[model samples]
Target: MAFADELKKLIGKGKQAAAQNSDKIEQAVDKAADFADKKTGGKYAQQIDKVQDAAKKAIPDK
Candidate 1:
C-alpha cells in the first residue's frame, strides 16, 4: 500500500480507539495541561486551557 493510504488507515484506527476511550483521553489531557500550567507557574493557564479543550474535542464523540 502507498504510504499515504497506510497513514490514513493508522489514523482511522487511532480515532476508533480514541472514541472508545474518550474519557481516558480527556483525563490524561487534563492531567497534562495541569502539569504544564504548574510548570509555567500558571502564566499560561488560559492558553493551556484552550489547548486542553481542543485536545479533548479532537477525540470522536461516537
Candidate 2:
C-alpha cells in the first residue's frame, strides 16, 4: 500500500539520522518517557520502561 511505502521511507530516513545522532535520539526518548511517567504519576512505569527498552533496542549506540 502507498501508506506502508511512505512509512517505510520515513523509517529509513529516521534510521539514517539516528545513526548520526544516536545520543540526541536517546535523550529525546528519555525525555519523552520521563514526561509520560510524570503525567501518569508512575502509574505506567512498567509500560514506559518497556517503551524505553524497545527504543534502545531499535536505535543502537553506533
Candidate 3:
C-alpha cells in the first residue's frame, strides 16, 4: 500500500478504537492534562483545560 493510503487506514482504525473506548480516552486526556498542569506549576491551567476539552470533544461518539 502507498504511504498515504496506509496512513489513512491507520487513522480510520484509530477513530474506530476511540469511539469504542471514548471514556478511557477522555480519562487518559484528563490525566495527561493534569500532569502537564502540575509539571508547569499550574501556570497554564486555563490553556491546559481548553486543550483537554478540545481533545475530549474530538473523540467520535459511538
Candidate 4:
C-alpha cells in the first residue's frame, strides 16, 4: 500500500513484461540501431553496435 511498495511492484512488472516481450524488444533495438546507422551514414557504426549489445544485455531473462 505504500509508495515504495508500489514502485517495486511496478519495476517487477516491467521486468516481467520485458522478458515476455524479449523478441519484440530485440527487434526494436535492431531497428533503432539501423536507423541511427543510416542517419549517421554508418560513421558511428561501432558505437551503435555497442549500444545495441548493451540494450540487449539490459533485458532480463524470462
Candidate 5:
C-alpha cells in the first residue's frame, strides 16, 4: 500500500483502539506522525502536521 493509505489505516486503527483504551490516542498519533515524517524524510512535514492536528481534534476526551 501507499504511504498515505498505510497511514490512514494506522490512524483508523488507532482511533478504534483509543475508543477502548482512551489514553493512548495521542501517543498513537505521535507515533504515526513520527513514522510519516521519517518515511517522507520530513519533506511532507506540513501534511503530517495537519494530519496530527486533525487527529488530536477528532479524538474524544477521556
Candidate 6:
C-alpha cells in the first residue's frame, strides 16, 4: 500500500483502539514518528513532534 494509505489505516486503528488501548496506540504513533524522523534524518523534527503531540492529545494516556 502507499505510504499515505498505510498512515491512514494506522490512524484509523489508533482512533478505534484508543478507548481500550491508548498506550498501544501511543506506542504505535511514537514508532511512526520515530521512523519518519529517522527516514528524514531529523529534517522535519518539528513537524514530527507536532504530529506526535497531536496523536498524544487525540489518545491521551489512561
**lDDT, candidates in the order shown:** 0.93, 0.91, 0.96, 0.97, 0.86, 0.87
Model 3 segments beyond 4 Å from truth?
A: 1-9
| Candidate achieving the largest TM-score | 4
| Tens-digit lDDT track of model 2 for 15-62 | 788888998888999999999999999999999999998997788556
Instruction: Name every residue pair that clashes in candidate 3.
Output: none
Tens-digit lDDT track of model 5 for 22-51: 557788899999999999999999999999
Can you write out model 4's per-residue Cα lDDT over 1-62, one digit (the tens) per residue?
69999999999999999999999999999999999999999999999999999999999888
lDDT winner: 4
Candidate 5 lDDT (Cα, 0 to 1)? 0.86
Candidate 3, poorest ten consecutive residues by summed lDDT: 1-10
TM-score of 6: 0.67
Distance from true position, residue 36, model 6, in Å? 0.1
How many collisions between residues are there in candidate 3?
0
TM-score per candidate: 0.83, 0.73, 0.79, 0.96, 0.64, 0.67
Q: Model 1, clash count? A: 0
As for lDDT, the candidate ahead, 1 or 6, is 1
Off by over 4 Å in 5: 1-20
Please give, for residues 1-62, the per-residue lDDT of candidate 1 as tens digits: 69999999999999899999998888999999999999999999999999998998888987
Poorest stretch of ten by lDDT in candidate 5: 15-24
Candidate ordering by lDDT (highest first): 4, 3, 1, 2, 6, 5
* Residue 62 miss distance in model 3 (angstroms): 1.4
- Residue 57 of model 4 has an lDDT of 99
